[model samples]
Target chain A: MRRKASLILLALAVFFTALSPLLRWYAFPRLAKIPANQYQDMVLEAKNATLLDYGTMQAKTVPKVTIVQTLKGDVDAAKKIDKTAGRDVVVWDGLSYVQGPDGKMVSSIPERYIFDAHTQDPVHATGEMVDGDPVKRDGIEFKWPFLTQKRDYEYFDAQTRTTNPIHYKGTENFRGVKVYYFEQTIPWTKVPFPKTMPVKGITPESVAKTGTTRWYTTVRKFWVEPVTGAPVYGEELHKEELRGGTLLGDRDKVTAFAGDVKMREDYIKHTVALVKSNRTLVLLMVSYLPWGFLTLGLLLLALSLYLEARSRRPGDPASTEVQEPEPVNA
Target chain B: MRALIAATTGLVLAFALVLTITAMGSPMGKTSPKPLLTTVPAHP
Candidate 1:
């Protein structure tokens, strides 16, 4: 009974293991060819927007764009166009610089612009924060600078050693039309605002500190249409503090993002292909596991039996009884 | 006992060989060049 059970197990292992490769071979091609929109659009967006020196204080933003647009006028016809509209990501560098009043290029603070979801164009924007005042609305308060200010705000208070307005900035390139960039003073406050503004369920107080723990983000970026100047895509990169046991100490880290404005069709197809290939590999691996275990178990049983047979002497009762000793005393 | 073990081993070996042969015969290859479903019919 025990031997039979082992054999059954071995068979199962062999069948499963062998079947894995076949399953992978069949599945990957299908998986790899998934509609390009779902996969490629998000990947392209992620790759395009990233901060340089990600971990350091002195970080720079480098945003790259590779758009796949369908042709309308005189152009190559055979070339594959990613009909996946809204896949193009508009990247705005957070660490860009602008010439300050003293004729020095200073680190930019904050700016705003809207990008279209379908057309992927810059429709509206706030030029730059040239002036503003620090107001205390909620528990926390910071300065809100305007772009049309008379003079650029200074970062340092010479004698007091206090850092002045911390600025945020961004740039937009609207295909041959215009290249717009701006810097502004973004107020870090804790006062909640009425739900009437563009961001409904948010408040000034939520954006108080760099690593403040909250349910949602208080700051965000958006892509807009250049003509109508309406926002198309709005996204916020959120951060959270890691647990105590993790290798990274308690620090603010980007957790997740919501919304994919420029969803492309071709991108999704490409993504499916990659996913299919991975799935196929997994199936193949699983198929072989049972077979591997069975082979090892059987080999072990065979060795044990051989050892037991060899250990007994040829004339010993164990061996001699089996043959029925041939008329020993006859 | 010796005969029983030999028979069990042989049977297992035979079953294993059959399974392997079946697997080999299946049209499984590194790449399956099946046609992809690329388009959806337009809604009227």
Candidate 2:
């Protein structure tokens, strides 16, 4: 019995250890999946020094945009676009309300965004997002178990219309939460000014003849929790430059923007709340169960090894019984 | 005891193997390509 128990325990340990990674990789994607109809609030802002540096200092007001995101439906048509159907797709609708000149709140940005439940990749985006096409190629695809020393995320630029890499910087504790740090460098993109804006050196004639002069680039940093995938803090550094007046002169103009105005104020109270409030099942599946299985399996294995060794001792009845007495004979 | 342990352990191992095999055959991420790069360019 002891020998048998040992074998069983050892087998269980091996089974569990081997199963741990597979479960983590496959099960977590489904287990921790985000659901439809959940909501998130994203706020963006620009200040005085930033506006002044960007040549909009005289504007006399801080610009702010507050958007509310709501997931509307499930993967009713994910296969239509993303063939992989590897991810659960959701239809997300959004609206941004801003104070109108009359002091009444009026709707500003109305749009739709598609997202994958597993990876949180934005599949399709329209409206203001499509204008710049900034998030390129599943920009936020994160492999599950955000716990890692270093990782890279694929990001897209709207102005240049290309994809770039977001690199993991390090980890640090923020607001009592441990978080992973990542930074992405956005290469400078040629400024495409609107016809109405009065650029100092450019005449209608030069505007027609020239390609571009003013350029903008951005640096984005994120601090996210490993288990919950919640962003405890984030910041964006927006800068602009005029290369030798490529538009007309040689002096480079650079401006640094304070990105995500409202986020800085609240420290992701909304998004963090959204994550913390939801996914009871998902969190358990992704983070705890697999580890539990591994621990149980290892314990069983150790017990089994001990039993097998005890059964093999020379003084043990089972070991001696296995050897036949000099048999019979006379 | 030997009979019971042997039977139970064998059954569990077999069951685990089957589960893993099923997962492998299913539409898993492993079988799917790197989804982002594979997507058709959305830009105009």
Candidate 3:
């Protein structure tokens, strides 16, 4: 009975020791993924920004400008892609809308991004595009991968429709959570006019007919929590221009929009809180549970060995039984 | 009988653990409560 108990304990110790690595490496990769139907929205503000008034063909100073970006997952689209791609994927239909202080529309761009749910790597599928143009994305965008490292990453810019290296600058504590800082600079590139214009009858075709070309450049920055790969805080120094067009008259060029865009205070606070909680959840799989199980397994193993040794000792009564003299009358 | 019970208990515990971890990592079911933006009125 004592030996049986030891065997049971020893089996359990081996089981737990084996389970630790399985949970961390196998289960984590298979189970930890972005959901197919996740939806999120963010609001950013730019104060004292420059926006061009197409009506007057002049740059005007606005007290405030707002950008609202939304990303909604398309479940059906993802399911369809999963069949052919042979892996889990997520499709996010995103829109970025800009508005002036008067609550008037400035520009709106719609995008479709498809990527691997676990790795956040762009997946080129049937409907992946940006600003109504077919694009094959080559790098990360909007979000980073799990366990982001302190190295440069190729980041995609929707406006320029180009991928560039975004360098990791350093580490910093953001709202009591450690985060990695990344920065990307996009050079001035001639981009197409927005498919959606603020003014009626002023379409991209109309702008092009007038010989006006749009140009854009930006310096993007993010403070990303490494564990969850989510940006807790982000900002951009964004600028746009319209140049050499009848729309601009004799002026060489006019600033279409120029501002320092930052996440709203409320959104920043909420994001920090969300990332903090997610960090713990991820750590459980990657660190806490694995190590805890390993430690428990080691302790159980020691106990099992001690019990077996004590039961088998030479002087133990259980091991050596006293012989009873048999009385034979003879 | 005792060995059988111990083995069964270990299997059940292992199954329960994997189930809990997978469920915890799964995606939330709630959708967006409200539309993010109002429809833009046609520009005059």
Candidate 4:
């Protein structure tokens, strides 16, 4: 009985020790998920320049930015796709508005997107983007699973109408925990669009000089928690320039227009605060408890072994009980 | 009787500890990021 009990305890200890780290999966998504009713207040200062002549610099304009992202889960995007338990598919609309000289706010380009609740991929968008294929895979946009290891992510670029394969840079010490770094580089190219399309917010004289150049370049970088796949900090810098004449010619001299040069920075500071608070509990379970159970269990097993050996010594009561009865033969 | 008692006591206590820790250690569900926009009015 003693031996059996001791063995059982030892086995139990091993079970917990081995199983601890795997619990990260269960803890992360449930603990760190982005809510459907999420709202973010951020600003993007668009740098626009006015030229005295074709090449002479004149003045600069700083536009105001107040973007609001809200979820619309009620609208069904795809009926054939099955709903996932614990996950909601949502369409989030973001409007980037810049106040014009008339003092009225005007809509910015690439206004809206749809997203996976967990992945943050822009699965769909409307307007000029309606014809282009919806984005398929964007891994770095939202919360990463706790089990995520080293990986390259194809972060979609809505402006270019293409997916930029942003490679995983490595891990960084972030907010006292390890987070991942990813980056994207977009070279100059004609984004998928029709030529001769009217460019919004540009003067006809400039538009006539411009003749519609769809060329653009973009780059983005982000830091995310590796364990939970949560983003800590992010920055995206996208620059575009309209070459003079038509989209066909690589006319370098006639840089007719400097496209939108904007930088956006975002971080989950509040999420970090919550993560810090939960760190202790996660650490105890994944690191401390297993070792504690194993050590205590081994000690108990050792004690049981010693007690058995001591009781079985030649003159001990247990040994005598087993000895043959000589005088009791009467 | 004494050996059985000691063995039973140690095993029971260890098992109880494991169970207590497991139950106590269940992860608490974190509240989703706040100021999550429940409604966005029609654009002007």
Highest lDDT model number: 3
Q: Best candidate, TM-score-wise?
A: 3
**lDDT tens per residue, model 4, A109-170:** 33334555544544433321322344444433434444356888766565566666777899
Task: Give the per-residue Cα lDDT of candidate 4 at B15.
Answer: 53
| Candidates, ranked, lDDT | 3, 2, 4, 1
Tens digits of per-residue lDDT for model 3, A127-204: 899888999999999999999999999999999998899999999998899999999999899999999998998999
Let me know the DockQ for model 1: 0.04
Candidate 4 pairs with clashing backbones = A37-B36, A37-B37, A38-B36, A38-B37, A39-B36, A144-A229
Q: Which residue runs of candidate 3 sit more than 4 Å off their true CA positions?
A: A318-330, B1-44
Selected candidate, larger TM-score, 1 vs 2: 2
Docking level for model 4: incorrect
Chain A TM-score values for every predicted structure, listed in order: 0.20, 0.58, 0.96, 0.57
Report the C-alpha lDDT of model 1 over A1-330, residue by residue, as the tens digit.
333444444444444434444334432222222111221112122223332231342223334211221111111110112222223212121111222122232222222212222233332223211112222111101111111122323332211213344222444543222212222222332222211222333333433323333232223343322222222233333221212122223544433222222323454444344434543444443345334545555565565455456445566454433345567685
lDDT against true structure, model 3: 0.86
Using alpha carbons, what is the TM-score of model 3?
Answer: 0.89
The DockQ values of the predictions, listed in order, are: 0.04, 0.07, 0.17, 0.10
Q: Rate the local accuracy (lDDT) of all candidates.
A: 0.30, 0.51, 0.86, 0.47
Candidate topping DockQ: 3
Clashing pairs in 2: A6-A304, A13-A297, A134-A158, A136-A156, A213-A247, A242-A253, A244-A249, A244-A250, A245-A248, A245-A249
Candidate 4 C-alpha lDDT tens digits along B1-43: 6445654654565456555654453332332344333222233
